[model samples]
Target: MSLVRSAGLQKFRQSVEALGGDPEVYARRAGLPVDALDSDELLVEDSALAAVLEIAAADLGCPDLGLRVGRAQDFGMLGPLAVAIQHSPSVADALACTSRYMFVHARDLSVALVEDPDGSHGVVGLRYSFSAGKRPLPQATDMTMLFLHRAVEFLVGGRYGLRSVDLPHQPAAPRSRYEDAFGARVRFGRDAALLRVPSSLLSRPLDGVDETLRRLALAFLSQQSSEARPLVTAKVRTVLDQSLGTGSTELVDVARALAVHPRTLQRQLAAEGESFASVLDSVRRARARTYLTTTDMPLSQVSDLIGFAEQGVLSRCAQRWWGRTPSALRQEARSRARPRA
Candidate 1:
């Protein structure tokens, strides 16, 4: 009964259509929500996705369909999780973040760094698996493994020293296809989906690491993780933060971002003793405080950044929230930051 984010199916429709099959037909036959295909906002049953993938592979006679789909997808499919991983200091840290928060993508999927199967020194194993019951999911497994390899490739900006790939199920595609996908030797009928890498590569640093963006992205993912069991308010606040400057902070827009109906979003917020306007104002106030204190940006620019239409509006809000003008607040912040003489 575990759910997977539909982003996992990023190229599903086009991939199916390219193979001359109706994507909707495959989805419906497998009990999948047809509308959720290739979407990021909705969750689908993991088993249903596995079923559709197997069905498509069988009908299209394309055993490597999963690999194709996986190959086409990039880190952007991961949304904020990608941002967090990309900014990680090292490849190992990125993998660790993925392993810890992958439930934000799929509840029953596991990605871990493990010991090499052959007890080989100076080698490490990266394993990927789905807990989708006894039913064989060669296609989904292939796709996910290829995805993991590609993700690491993106992180390290190249091949990542892959030595071999091992899968639990027999090759759905030709052995060469799997090997080609990973650019390494492919072994079938093994214990799990594992990629062997030189242990040294584990410590390789990622380029363009940004501590601030990484912290923000990790905070967002942590809030979205199942362990957080986040309330509707948190979700709404997150959507607001992303959409604030875009002039789309309406209830409908936030609800759409969350894949929920407006009324449903409102009702959930009300159940928690909140409302959309109140949340929006709270977000604005917090953002205002951060901008006024941290940077010397002009009031007009700060107004736009926080979703207000004019500087006058920001001035009024500053008065309401802190009983002072935005300029006065910024001056006070500057004074506090100054060294005492």
Candidate 2:
């Protein structure tokens, strides 16, 4: 069972009720015991909870219901801080303030406003670095992006959408749902999940402002750090790094590198919601893209650098991983690098 502790629980319940579902029934479907739903403990873990949310959304005829719930929850938890941002002089300041306060309850996530050097625009991106035994699932990342997109839209009262949405896993279902939810080009199987929004949106005015609320929110966030890293993730990353550039990468190699038996490493990684295959694939895919785009090196040479035995094998894997051919990827990279008219 996975644990869940959302600061927006009350708001989530209200949203569910508004959407025409009994909160108790929703909680029960989510696998939470009856008392667990009403208790003030603020933490519960039952796979059924996520399932319940999905089912509730489907029943309510809101394909974006999950997104709506997430936004309400985020707003309930961060509204005061958001109001303070609304009073700020510029979008940049608002984003910086929001980013600071948003982490109060969820320090596992990071948000940044990255400005383009040419002064064209900026991007607001989110990064999640999970603690040991707590890597987020792909659905969780998608839900978070959906919430952020909706919250920004609510703040601006405009049809705001991401410039790009990046994910670490390939799409498991039809692509239309992703397209409908994000309204942006989605890139999957990448190192980290990211949702890129225009920098200008950061400067837009918010609907409320309250200094006291901001202060309170900041205080609350300061007290929460359950998302901090554990030594395990660092070790896993290290093992992955060393195993790359060699065709001998395997579970055994990872176990030996971490000074544990293979089974122990497997169990530990499983606890963290990852497997050796997933980590290795991430490392190779990231390195492959870096080599392909950053250098004029031939595809075969790039394959060698990333530990592929043959260019053909690398090409096949890259296509499956990125949904694009090598030549097409290179062309797209060049186009992105070109100067705008």
For residues 112-219, write the lDDT of model 1, one tens digit per residue.
999999899999999887664443488888888888888888888887789899888887778888887889999989987799999999789999999999999998
State the number of backbone clashes in model 2.
6
Worst 10 residues of 1 by lDDT: 222-231
Local distance difference test values of all predictions, in order: 0.82, 0.60
Error in Å for residue 74 of model 2 = 6.4
**Candidate 2 residue lDDT tens string, 190-245:** 66666676766655665565657656756654554446322344467556666677
For lDDT, the strongest prediction is 1
**TM-scores, one per candidate:** 0.68, 0.47
For model 2 the local lDDT of residue 173 reads 38
